[model samples]
Structure formats: C-alpha cells, structure tokens
Target chain A: MIELKNIKKSFDGLEVLKGISMTFEPGKTNLIIGQSGSGKTVLLKCMLGLYSVDSGSMLFGNRPLENMDDNQRRILRREIGMVFQGSALFDSMTVLENVMFPMQMLTDQDEKSIRAAAHEVIDRVNLNEATQKLPAELSGGMQKRVAIARAVVMRPKYLFCDEPNSGLDPKTAIVIDNLIREITKEYNITTVINSHDMNSVMEIGDTILFLKDGLKAWEGNKKQIFKTDNEAINNFVYSSRLMKKVKEVYQ
Target chain B: MKLLHHIGAYLLMLRLVFIKPTKAKVMRKLIFKDIQDLIVGSLGIVAFLSFFVGGVVAIQTALNIESPLIPKSLVGFATRQSVILEFAPTFMCIILAGKVGSFITSSIGTMRVTEQIDALEVMGINSVNYLVFPKLVAMMLLPLVINISMFLGILGGYTATLYGGFSSSADFIDGIQMDFKPFHVFYAFIKTVVFAIVLATIPAYQGYYMKGGALEVGKAATVAFVWTSIVIIVLNYMITQLLLA
Candidate 1:
C-alpha cells in the first residue's frame, strides 16, 4: 500500500498540491481525476519522486520516499513501474527489446530467462505478432500495450499510468482500462493512475481521488462518486454529456 | 551571468556523466553502436573533404610561387606545411562540427523531446552516463579518422603537385622530407584529440539541456554547432601557441 500524508508541492512559489492526503491500497486501481491545472499530474509526479515536496511525507509501504538516499531511491525506483502519457517506448528498440530493457538493466537474470520473461509479458499484453516491430511501426493502442508490457515485465510492486487512454478510441480505451485492472488485481500491485477520462473512472476506478485547484475535493469509488453532492466533483462529473444525461434522469 | 551558468552546468553534467556507471554489458553495446554511428559512418566524408582540400592547397601554393628565384620543391614543402599544420586537423574538424555536431545534437534533443531520457531516469538509470558516456568513448577513436585525413591529405597534395606539373615527384618527395619535425605531426594529433572532446561534449550539452519541442531541437543543433566551432577554433589557437609558437 502507498500512503500520502499532507503532500504539498510547489513550482516557483505557486503551490500545486496543497497538502493532499490519500491512501492507495494494493490490489485495486486508484484513479486521481481532475481537470486541467488541477494538480493531479503534479501529485502523481511527486509520488513518482520526480518532484520534491515542500513539506509533506509520502510513504511507500512505510518507507518515506522524501528522505531516501540515492541508492535507496534507485532501489525503490526499480520496484515502481510507470506508463507515461506518451507511452515513451524507446523508438529504436523493437517490441521484445523494449519489454526486456528493465530486466537487462536491473536484474542479474541470464539472457535466456530474460527473453522468456519478456515474451511472457509480451504475450500478456497480446503483442505477440509485433515482437520485432519498432515503436514507430505500432499503432497508438499497440504502443500503449508495449509500454505496459515493458512496465510490468519486472512485476513491480507499484504501477503508475499517466493518461493511459488519452489517444485511444473508446473500445480500445476500455480494453486498456480492463487490462490495467486485471494486472493490478493479479499482481496485488498498488496502481495509481492520473486520468481525466470519465469512462476510465467509471469502468475501472475502484477508488477515486478528486482534486480541485490543488485540494482534495472528494474521495470515493465510481459507484459512490455519482451520488456525492460536492459542487466541484459534481461540476466535473456533469460536465460529461453522458453524466449530464444521467443527472437529468435523476432529476 | 548566463554564460557562467551554462559553463557551470556543463561541468556538472560532465561530472555526472562518469558516475554510477552503466553496466559494462550495456555500455559495450552502446559504445559499439556509437562507433558505428560516429566513426565508421563518418569515414567517407572526412576522406572526400581531405582529398579535395589538400589538392586545392597544393594548387594554390604552386600558383603563388611564380618567381624563378624559388625552387620547384618549395611547392611541395608549402603544400605539406599547409596540409599538416592547419587544413587537415583544424579545418576538417570545423567542417565535422557541421556534420557530426549537428547529428549528436539533433538525436539527443529528439530523445529529450520525446521523453526517452525520462524513461531512462524512471528506470533508475543514470541517463547522462547511459547517453553521453558512450558517445565520449566512441569519440576517443576520433584520432584514427584524423590520421587517415592527414595521410590522404598529403597523398592528394602529392598527386596534385606531380600531375599539375608544379613539381617533379622526386622534388616533391624531397620537399616532404625537408626539416620534417616529428613534433609538428605530434602537435597536429594533440590538437585532434582535444578537438575531438570539444566536438563530442559541447553538442551533447546543448542537446541534453535543450527545452521546447521539435523546432527547438533544430535550433539547438544550430546553437551546438556554433559553440563547438567557436571552442574548437579558440582551442586550436591556444594549442598552436603553446606547441609551435
């Protein structure tokens, strides 16, 4: 499990994460949702250790991430898997090579075992036919799958996805969402996703942290989120056409 | 102040580049790839420029010695002097700053633009060592290319002087042997090694620290070339003063 206690982050004296606190349990998809400039990405980056928080503590399973030495941080980083908003696969490497990169860099596994491990995840992501294809040759959805395979090939304790469904079509987006949820449950990984896609929030958002203007405005699951009357989250939820129709039916 | 900041940052980057070294297994692969990209890929152009420019120097030197008071062998000696002392080491590197410098800058800058560097970092890899050190190691072999340039340059000088009727083969060969200080060749090579470092690092610094998107990558390449050439020319002057003057 990952826990944040009063997490605050600022850039150039402008505070982005305003002492936000939340618990992300293992074996579930924890979605952080907010509109543009609402600090969801900032919060995610801080948890990822990409940004240093001003005066708050982030506990990754009782180990405070803010105070770790370089060696400790590196060890922790290896246990954390990130799927970037752009999918960020090395364009030069083929699908198999990209999947096998982390293991080759960090593990003592032999080549035969590493190849088998990479193929296992490649199969998990259903990218078996594109093993030799570079990232440029893959479609957007396929690229995301490659990124996912690379991220989870090591069987990380934590998984972070930044807008995993941004450019994918609706059907492909749902597939990616379900894939992440299934992987999270199977591995018992603490999965934190930063997204604005309502479909993702409703489909696989086992837990949701709603941030508004740098503050945690509400906390709940997809089932409970619609029933809440928090004005900020209501604005967010009803801003969607589908949610607007749902609100009309409720009225 | 901004210049001082860049210099400080550049030095810091150099410091970071050698620390927490990437695994030797990975580094060996990276080094070979860089060699393929940086050294083997560059042989043809370096050879072409050296040959043609060496011929030009000989023809120009021959034309200028029009008076009967001068021996025909002086044509060969002057060609040797120009090619060895300046054209092959300094001028050729300046040209390479355009070819190779831009290449290093654009490729790294594109990686930055695409967030590949961040991917390396998130994997607990030292992105600097992973990216720049391989290029640095590959450029250590740069002197080999410079040696070839020097040889092909003199060969071009020999061909031009002999075939252009400016000097006899014997006179030209004799002139090449005239007062040949091994130090001059040593000096040229010393300059090549130093210039090689400048060629590899300055462009890399520009690319690694560059911000903005695809357009900024092209701009950074231009900026890296300009700064690399300027440093190379300045270093050439300083080295010449110390060694030859």
Candidate 2:
C-alpha cells in the first residue's frame, strides 16, 4: 500500500498540487483521474519521486520517500515500473531488446536467461509476434502493449501507468485497460493509473481519487462514482456526451 | 542562483560520469560507436584538408621566395609547421564540433525530451554515467587519433607536391627538419586535448538539459553547434596567444 500525506508541489510559484493526499491500496487499481492541467500527473510523478514535494511526505508501505538519498531512491525506483503516456519505448532498440533492457541493466543474469525472461513477458502481453519489430514499426496499440511488456518484464512491486489508454481506439483502450487490471490482480502489485478515460474507471477502478483544480475533489470506486452527487465530479463525468446520454437513459 | 544550480548539476553529472564508469555497459557501446563515427568517419575530410592545405602552403611559399636565400624545399618545412601547429588540430576539432558534437547533442537531447533518460533514471541507472561518459571519453581520445591521421595526410600532400615538381623530396625533408620544433607538436597535442573536452562537454551539457519535444532537440543541437564553434574559436585564439607568445 502507498499513502500520501498533505502532498504539495509548485512550479515557479504556481501551485500545481495543493496539499493533496490519498491512499493507493495493493491488489487493486488505484486511479487518480483529473482533466488536463489538474495535477493528476504531477501527483503521480511526486509518488514516483520524480518531483520533490514542497511539504508532507509519501509512504510506500509506511517508508517515507522524500528523505532517501539518490542511491536509496534508485533502489526504490527499481521496484517500481512506469508506462508513460506515449509508450516511451527506446526507438533504437527492437521490441525484444526494449523488453529485456531492465533485466540486462539490473540483473547479473546470463544472456540466455534474460532472453527467455523477455520472451515470456512478450508472450504474456500477446506481443510475441512483434518481438523483432521496432516501436516505430508497430501500431499505436501494439506499441502500448510493448510498453506494458517492458514494464512488467521486471515484475515490479509497484506499477504506474500515465494515460495508458490515451490516443488509443476505444476498443484497443479497453483491451489495454483490462490487460493492466489483470496484470495488477495477478501480480498483486500496487498499481496506480492516471487517466481521464471513464471506460477505464468503470472497468478497473477498484479505488479512485478524483481531482479538480489540484485538489482532491472525491474518492471512491466506479460503482459509487455514478451515485455521487458532488457537483465538481458530476460536471466532469456528465460533460462527456456519451455519459450525458447514459445519464438521461438512467433518468 | 540559477548559474550556481547549473554548476552543481554539472558537478553532479561529472561525478556520475567518472566515479562509476562501467556501471552501464550500454555506455561503453556508445563510446565505441562515437569513436567510429567521429574518428573513423572523418578520415576523408582529414585527408582532403591535409593534402590541399599542404599544397597551397607549399605553392604560396615557393612563389614568394627568390633564388637560394631560402631553399625552394623550405616551403615543405613551413607547410609542416602550418599543418601541425594550426591546421590539423584546430581545424579538425572544428570539423568534429560540427559533426560528432551536434550528433551527440541531438541524439541525447531527443532521448531526454522523450523520457528515455527518465526511464534510465527510474531503472536505477545513472543516466549521465550511461549516456555522457562514453561520449566524453570517446571525444577526448579520438581527436588525438584524428590529429595523427591529419599529420599523415599532410605527409601525403608533401608527397604530392614533391612528385608534381613543386619541390624536391630531399629539399622537402631538409626544409621540414630545419623548421620543425618539438614544442610546436607538443602545443598542438595539448591544444587538441583541450579542444576535445570543450567540444564534447558543451554539446553534452546542452543536450542533457534539453526539455520539450523533438523540435527542442533540434534547437538544442543547433545551439550546441553554435556555442561549441564560438567557444572553440575564442579558446583557440587565447591558447594560441598564450602558447606562442
């Protein structure tokens, strides 16, 4: 489990995260959802130790992240895997090489063993056929799968996905979301996804934190999300044309 | 205050690059790749410049001298001095600053903007150690090799001049032996080393700090080339005055 307490951050005097705090439980998908410029990504980055918090602290199983030195933070970082929004695969590397990179860097394993481990994860992500392809050669959805494969290839204890379904087709987005959710459940990793996709919320948001203008506006699962009367979240949820139609149907 | 912060970051990056150089094997590969790209790839330019510059110096010196006051072959000595002391080291560095320096800046800057650097950081890898060290070492070592190649290229030009009847081979040898100073070569060698460091560090620093997107990487590369060229020219003048004076 991950716990954040009074987390605050600002860039050039513009406060982005304003004393926001939330918990991300293990064995479930904990989502931080907000619109563009709403501090969801900043909060995620803070949790990952990419940004130093101005005040308060983040605890990974009650271990404060802010006080650790570079080496200690690196070691902690090794236990976490991140899938960036754009599927930040190393373009110079083939898909197989990209997936095998973490193992090659962090482990003293032999080449044969590393290759085998990489292939195993590729297979798990249903990307076995495109192992030799470069990221540029793959479709948008395929690239995301490769990114996912690389992330889980290390079998990290904590997984972070930033807009995993962004720029993907609705069908492919659901597939990616389900894949992430299934992987989280199977590994029982503490998984946090930053997304604006309502489909993802309904499908795999076992725990959700909703943000509006850098503040924690609400917190609940998907089932409770639809039932909540919070005007801020209501405006965000019903702003989507499809959600509005769904609301009308329910009414 | 920002300058101090930048200096602190530079020191941090330098420490990371040197203290644990072999922590990242990929860095070793990158260094070797850069050596091939910079030294091996610049062979044609070195050969062309050395021959043409040597020929031009020989021809110009031959035209000005009257009779036997200076041996017609003393032109070769002047040519050698020009190539070794000024042309080979300085011009070669300028060429490399344009070529390898820009390449490093753009590639690494693109990686930075794209979050590949962050990926390395998140993977418990020192991005500087993995990315900058190899390129720095490669740039430092490869320029000396290119200087040697440039020297041999000047010799090729001497051969061309002698064969074309611009001067006698014996006279050429005699001329070079008369004007050659051990200190001149030493100065060139030291200057090349300094040039290599400046060329590599400036670009790598610019590249490492790049933010934004693909366009920004291009902007960083352009900035690196411009700044490196300016620095090289300014330092060349300063060092030349200091050493030659």
Clashes of each: 0, 0
Query: In model 2, which regions exceed 4 Å deviation?
Result: B1-12, B20-26, B64-68, B163-165
lDDT of 1 at B21: 92
Error of 1 at B30 (Å): 0.5
Top-DockQ candidate index: 1
- lDDT digits (tens) for residues B1-245 of candidate 2: 98688668766766777764544466667778877876677677667767777777777777778877776767777777778877788877787788888888988898888788888877777788788777777777755665665567568657767767778888887877885679887888888888888777788888998888888888888888887888888988999899999
By summed lDDT, the worst window of 10 consecutive residues in model 2 chain B runs over B19-28
Q: Using TM-score as the measure, which candidate wins?
A: 1
Chain A alone, TM-score for each of the models?
A: 0.98, 0.98
State interface RMSD in Å for all models.
Answer: 0.8, 1.6
The C-alpha stretches of model 1 lying farther than 4 A from their native spots are: none
Query: Highest lDDT among the candidates is held by which one?
Result: 1
What tens-digit string does per-residue lDDT give for candidate 2 at A116-203? 9999989988988899999999999999999888898888889999999989999999999999999998998999999999999989
DockQ of 1: 0.77
